[model samples]
Target chain A: MSEMTGWLLVWPILLPVLASALAVVAWGRERTQTLIGFAGLLAQFVAALALFVQVWAQGPLAMSMGGWAAPFGIALAADTLGAGLTLIATLVALAIAVYAWADSTPEQRSGGLFPLVLALMTGVAGAFLTSDIFNLYVWFEVTLISSFGLIVLGGRREQIDGAVKYAVLNLLATTLLLIAIGLLYGLTGTLNMADLAAKVAQLPPGAALESIALLFLVSLGMKAALFPLYFWLPAAYHTPLPAVSALFAALLTKVGVYALIRVFTTVFPEGFALTREAMAWAAAATMLLGALGALAEVDLRRLVSYTVVSGVGVMVAGLAIGSEAALLAAIFYIVHSIIISAALFMAAGLVVRSAGSADIEQLSGLYKGVPWLAVAFLLAGLSLAGVPPLAGFWPKVYLVQAGLDAGAHMLVVAVLLSGFLLLLTVGRSFALVFWREAESAATPASPAPGASAALAGGGRHLRYALGALVLLTLLLGLYAAPVVEVALRAASELRAPGPYFDAVLGTAELRP
Target chain B: MEPLIAIVVGALFAISVFLLLSGSLIRLVMGLFVLSNATHLLIFVAGRLTRENPPLIAEGMKVAEAGIANPLPQALILTAIVISFSLFAFVLVLTYRAHRSLHTVDTEAMRVAEPAPRAARLRGRDV
Candidate 1:
């Protein structure tokens, strides 16, 4: 209990913030920005791995910044779950930086893309690490602004339209979140999450805390793109460059899920009695609608965007289960979905680049040219559909088992139905793009719409980055023992908040 | 004071929601602006507005007076206001740019991204 590992918690947030500042100083220099962003993520990834290992061994690490005591100063804390997410986030971010650098389209390079991405990384890292609800809101704004900047990098009519919707919805969400935080502060007289938890559990169950919880749910639901509010996701996600889309698909909604899990598990663990039931229903609708949306889309990016929403629904259902086993499954699913979705988006980008269009009607046999890419794409599709022996399958298996254990019969059905629906949707896209041949093969200089795809120039690096991540998905599936163990431990820690409280408050208060 | 502020906050939120539901992009922007201001007011009121006795501790005092106002909420509101200001600025520029490029300030005409129902049906055979 020497409180030595606090530096690990700070490194993830500090490096990115500092790098963002440096990137600003070196602004408009694409070369310098790319280097700074990549190096920052590289450092973050390495630091995250070290932090994860440390947290797994030590339980949780926290520090009151500026040497201020608990309930007085800002606290940044990292448990197994937070560190693991930071690690995965940085890994994905590193891949995206490399892909965007490789893309080198003038739009990709301009509008301070690297700096904005670094700022986004800073926000995401801060969101995961901060132990104060108000601090979490601050990080949410940082993440939102940087994302808006990245979204409008191209300023195309479509991108601006997408950004408008994205900004309006997300800004509204953050505004509501701030209100929720203010109310929570008003109720408990403390903003530190641990202090609030201790204070909340002391208050008798009442409407005040319940209303704040609901506000948080609505706020986070918008961010997570829960049912009836997910139109903006599909509208905007596909308009950005593939690398940017991949980053958003990988991390943005997941942050929403992260906030939900963090708040429900930490502050309102036993507080929000009825919210879980509403969330369970919302989760089911989200899954069904998201899958059906995917099923009906001919545009590849749009299909994948719907899949992103579907994955959020699955994670949300696990959260609603609120059991340690269910949480473990949710964590595993988040990891799996992040990798698969990023890989799928990158694959679709290559397809769009090589084919000159992502319209399914325009696409034909891709197996003939880039056979390796076709194989990679097929693996991603199967993995997303939760095929056995893939990363997506195990998470669902755990989710189904846990749902049954919890007697959440609807959740179980929704989970299974979503898996099956995705299988049909992704399988059809795979077949249409890779299997069918052009009937009139003798006509044009460009390969037949049904012909195998050729890898467009400058896609070599993109494929390398994508291949690395997809290989990770395979590795996750084939050898999931360590990850599962870690996830289970994280869930168990969440089940008991004593350690989280102690970690943030340190040993000073442990004297009985 | 709290009740009056609550009513005002409610009114601001109501108008913003009404504006938000309109099809005009300008209205949408106004909706967000009004919505953010209402939220700030809500936070201000929720923090329990006390008249003018700030929670500053003198240099010699070990502890501050108990009845002094809670400065934390004010700090929180300040941070929120700054953040929302930046976000609103971005949204304003975005709306103006969107209008310039898409040639419409109407959300209904913002279908540059959405698929047309007719197109979806005609090509719907494969999906």
Candidate 2:
């Protein structure tokens, strides 16, 4: 790769870090901070798109942080997978920035929202681009702390309560991740992923290696909100401001799933049958339980959070299948989930604001009040439920096809069942929140006065952000072939990883 | 020395996990601090501790001489230390604020976010 192209690898991360510093300096001036956030995310988006285009055209790109060579220095690399995810992440961040511009209160903005969001983008981008194991851990912590700040931004009672559960569980997960990294480093004597891939392959298949893999699975599983470890997510996600919750719903857990795919496919490509099996079981259970959780929720935001969890389960099931087609489907699902989840949460936020309540029972007749938002909610929600002619459907189709081919019948059943459950949940929520009339005759069939006032002031920007995301999903669903092809190439890269090694280590044949 | 350190790390982990399971938020914060220290020690011990010269190369030498201590793990531990320390401080402050606002330190009482579901009173309502 050309040196210029390699610099593209740094821009996605660099732009955000720079912007965050600027935001910190511009603190207390909400307008300046918003402008800074826009400029930063826009530049990062451009860089991410350039990186994706370069990687797609040529191949994976890698660069050491300094002049040092691989296996010793930190390596930042972007294959189609990393570059693609970074592009989507930046796009999502920009959308949420716009949404927050309209939705967040001045108090929350002055609480350093702009800086925290930028820090979050930096961490998410770095996590995607880093090809070093230890660096990945560091980036994970970066994401963690920034998210902590965002979660407790206003410091309301519920926010603090939520932050407590969120903080304690996530800190433990990161610590466990550190312990796993230590064990892996001790075993392999290297932290660079390319180097570790070679060394780990040479190690005999035994308990020591398997246990390390298991540790990684457990830790990352918690981060991804996999079954039996997802309490923190639903417990805390709904407590934050709606816009803040949208950002978290969009980017946070996906990073966990991304890391899981990266580590398994790149660092330890084979000989973890037991671990893969455990993941498969977890995937099925997470899917079923997450959908059930969504089914059980009365609050709109909490219900949407459960859908994110269910979507993680779908993607993990693809990883468990461990085929080219399955990985492609998994990547496609992740891309779809990121956009759709953000759109759903933002739409839910509008509903809550318009009705002045999140409880479905207290919410009613929104279809007459704000027809556009109701449509947006249905569009995004249906896409999430894997309805036909939407972004969500294609992934499930491919996943089911791949699962059938692999004879993973149980996973196929789980995917289909979960999709059905999601459809029911969304439909039921819509019927309650938008279709039915208010039970209290004193209440009028109109948007709340506060909601209309806010809409008049800045809510159009909120609609624009949600509109762009929903439109993107629509276009993606319509024009899925190119994306599917890209996902196919990305999956192939993950399966082989020869180009990744060559890019990172400067030699492919160095490994025996 | 490595085995002994591993034992200590294991004990720290045990103690932290015990503390973490307590209902009190303060114990949870303390548990996290202990947990992070344990992880740092684990990383340190995993690097294979050595009693040797610092890993600086002598004048005109290309690489460090034999029997020099490995510097990589120390660097890694230092980064981990700073990160964990800052995060610990953040968690402590958050817990303190949570206590002040929620008026309780017991996790069981901190149910404002996810209070027990109201008893199905609106079940039959069409709206």
Candidate 3:
């Protein structure tokens, strides 16, 4: 039974790898690509759901790859938090695959894009599930490499430029992360995260540990695109195809945030009090700056990208609070942000495709021709702005409540102010695109055939996607009791490092 | 001998940092390569430079009886090397493409894709 439970932990990692391999072999055949992509996504979704169920029924699941134990061999573990993240990632991947199928051209579809997307999904799932710190680093590299391929797959000039910066910045982050992992291994004599968690504090505190912690924080911060490290994100995300952009906006930074939450809570809890405070301030600054940035942007895609930064700050603030309630809020906010961000990006794509521009200056009166798209955009935008009765509102309410509970008045203010700014930014775009009359008399009665056809099919698809997401978001908001219960359970598990250590080191005596 | 290797690794890291701080794109790429190698060396050092023997045990030998170098960090380093190799190759291609599109080899000149203006884009136009 224990062995079977262990194998359950490995399914998330295996599902994507198998799917990606099949996707690669079946490349250039659209039917095969779609079938492989959808089937893989469905399988991953089912596996993630089953994993969550098993974790809920039984406690956390652990597996050692190749029958080898931890510290010497790679391990994969899934707690409630990991299960939640896996669920979000799989659902988002599925939605993006569906969207990609609907939007991509025959040539775009043929260029092995599906395989790369599957590879990225596998990387993310692996990163979230892995128990070894070094394996986490490996999975991050997988994600980065796959992302680089996806970002530049279109071969557009702007995309190439964006991909270059994204690649360089991420590479720098990965190097820093590797150095930190090396230093950590030197100090702890273990690569397994659970083992490191147990042994990390037993070492004498000095410059070495401090430096390693700082290095890890900075590297993961850059990956999360927090505050000063976030300069690469807006431009890079804006240049990709909408579906790809949506996935990156939703999944990539959240992975970094997940790492931050995991390491801070479990491995480096002792020395992180001051660091959490600093992170709160950074989150505040990020929120304000990102909102201000969005307010200044004219392009819809770029505006949405900046909004990602703003949303990130809210989630970071939740993490920084470091209480059970705050952790719950962070989890809720992460799931909410991924869904809302993806929907908004897809809507922006639809507008760009229809109006022949991403700039709101040139786009007007879209509501008349594409009412469904407009409505989807409105719901997604309102949710992003944290309007009531939508998915976005609950996360904000929880986060703000958590802030107050933690006596973080400044973060509360930052959260409210950013919400206001988000409203203004998204509201302005809504007005320009959905309310204003078309500016050019020469503007066609309808969009071009390809754009129109996509718009017609895509409108229904976007509505369906947004409707499903909105339902989940609403359910999460309205009956957040169960989700909060799960989050608190996950938080307690994180707070107590004993199980993690035992799982990793077997029967070894704990030094502390 | 191990200390000497550590010194060389430190020097390599210093040189890489200097190159990274320089304004040339090519230098930056070279710097990244050097830094990756330095990290690889760091991992090698972390495994504790034992010259005794491989970690593999002989037939019928108990695990505790084998005095061998830790193989885990070496394995980690091998994986890191492969990842870094692919990263370097990809970055080279990106540099070529970026240079082709932007028509510059200077890192400073490649700042056309800054995020500030894009974020403040209230003047909506075709992106």
Tens-digit lDDT track of model 3 for A189-276? 8888877876887878778887787787889888998888998898689888888998999899999989988877777886555576
In model 1, how large is the Cα lDDT of residue A219?
95
Superposed by TM-score, candidate 1 places the C-alpha of residue A502 at a distance from the truth, in angstroms, of 0.2
Writing each residue's lDDT as its tens digit, candidate 1 over A1-512 gives: 45456777878888888888898888778788778888888887888888888888878888788777787888888888898999999998888788888875655675788888888998999999889899999999999999999998877778888888899889888888888888888888898999988898898888888999999998999999998778889999999988999999999999999999999988999646579888998999999899999988878999999999999999999999989989999999999988988999998887777666777656777666667778889898889989978899988999999999989999999999999999998888888776777423421333444334344566678788888888989999999888899889889988987888888877233221
Whichever of 1 and 3 has more DockQ, that candidate is 1
lDDT of 1: 0.85
For each of the candidates, give the backbone clash count. 6, 0, 10
Q: What is the full ranking by DockQ, best candidate first?
A: 2, 1, 3
Residue by residue across B21-80, what tens digits does model 1's lDDT show? 999989989998999889888877866777776777878997677566677787888898
**What is the C-alpha lDDT profile of model 2 across A1-512, one tens digit per residue?**
45677788999999999999999999889889989988999999999999999999899888887767677888899999999999999998899999998888888898999899999999999999999999999999999999999999888888999999999999888888989998899888899999999999999989999999998999999999988799999999998888889999999999999999999998878738889899999999999899998988899999999999999999999999989999999999999999998999999888877877788766777777688898999999999999989999999999999999999999999999999999999999999888887555634534544456646678899999999999999999999999999899999999999998989988222221
What lDDT does the true structure give each of the candidates? 0.85, 0.90, 0.81
Lowest summed lDDT over 10 consecutive residues: which window, candidate 2 chain A? A442-451
Name the candidate that leads on TM-score.
Answer: 2
